[model samples]
Target: MNIHQVSVNYAPEQDRLLIRINGKEGGELRAWLTRRLALALLPVLNQSATAQMTKLAGPAAPAASLDEQRDQLLDTFQKEALLRTGDFKTPYEDRQGQPANAVLGPEPLLLTEVKVTLMSSGQLRLQMLEKLPGSDTVRNFQVMMDGQLTNGLLHLLHQSLNASQWLEPVAPANLTPAGSSEVPELAIEPAKPRYLN
Candidate 1:
């Protein structure tokens, strides 16, 4: 959809984000974006040794704490997305890959302007500037017969987006040694066909 305006306000104290749209509310857009952001930030967060150290020193430390933290982070992130939309019916999957269809109804109003702001407290704010339109921007919705089919498409999209970083020349070890002594010769076989008299 044609985005008319975009603004993002950050509220560092809240550790959340808000997103708004002006024209026709984009279905699953918020989830898609939150997933994107989480994917982008998760590695950095996980790699933060200082954060890990602090958590280790915190109260009630347990062996599963790290995993718990990851779950909490993801939950918080999705919650932030929900808050931004204000239309709660958005579908989101939990850490266990279970679908949580908490909210229901028509999608939120779409706006021409999409604003995203990350507050200092790590909160994100999204604002959408919408305008009335004669025609609907988003027209089609299809349910995939299999969940894996949808997942496969998402995986392909993710791979395409991340492919740049993983693109490297094949290592020498991965290639056949040019001067190696062993070489196999191709075998040729003749086939004969008989015609009935």
Candidate 2:
């Protein structure tokens, strides 16, 4: 479906991020992202965004040749450039007063699994699923996002996460690689991506 707008907000009471996607064709898809899922999903999102940035950079400039620091700087520059051009100031249009346009159901889907892959068309494909308890039921939904939309979604998720105070302890200041003076042997493993068919 063609997306019209995307919204991500933290719900303090639910302690989860509410993602609402309004399709240009007239339906809205809502999902709840819990802390556990967010922790696993954020890194994958970052990786995918970086991949897109590198693809846009083209074959002339290979990201592999650059040092870690330089590559990071380039990624930052690309992300900022794309983000600056996006129209994030416009408020997300929700189907509140009008007839319910929730395509899934009245309540948001409680996401149990998420998979993401960069498509051949240079768009990010996202698949979110909800597995019902005590039954063999798994409802799924899919959406494709361009680089700008991916970056926008990442920005929104980061803002909501900060507001939720869930990453305060592991904030940028506190993060240290293995064998550092501040923290030692920080057994952090690289994010393993899930394959999507």
Using TM-score, give the best candidate's number. Answer: 2
Per-candidate local distance difference test: 0.34, 0.82
Off by over 4 Å in 1: 1-105, 134-197
Count residue pairs with overlapping backbones in model 1: 45
Worst 10 residues of 1 by lDDT: 141-150
TM-score of 2: 0.72
Model 2 residue 119 CA deviation in Å: 0.9
Estimated TM-score for each candidate: 0.19, 0.72
lDDT of 2 by residue, 1-197 (tens): 79888999999989999998888877678889999999899999999988876675554444565586597777777755974366779999986333224356677889999999998777899999998789676767899998889988998999999998998786445566787766544566899999999
| Top candidate, metric lDDT | 2
Those runs of model 2 whose alpha carbons end farther than 4 Å from true positions after fitting are 61-80, 96-103, 170-197
lDDT of prediction 1: 0.34
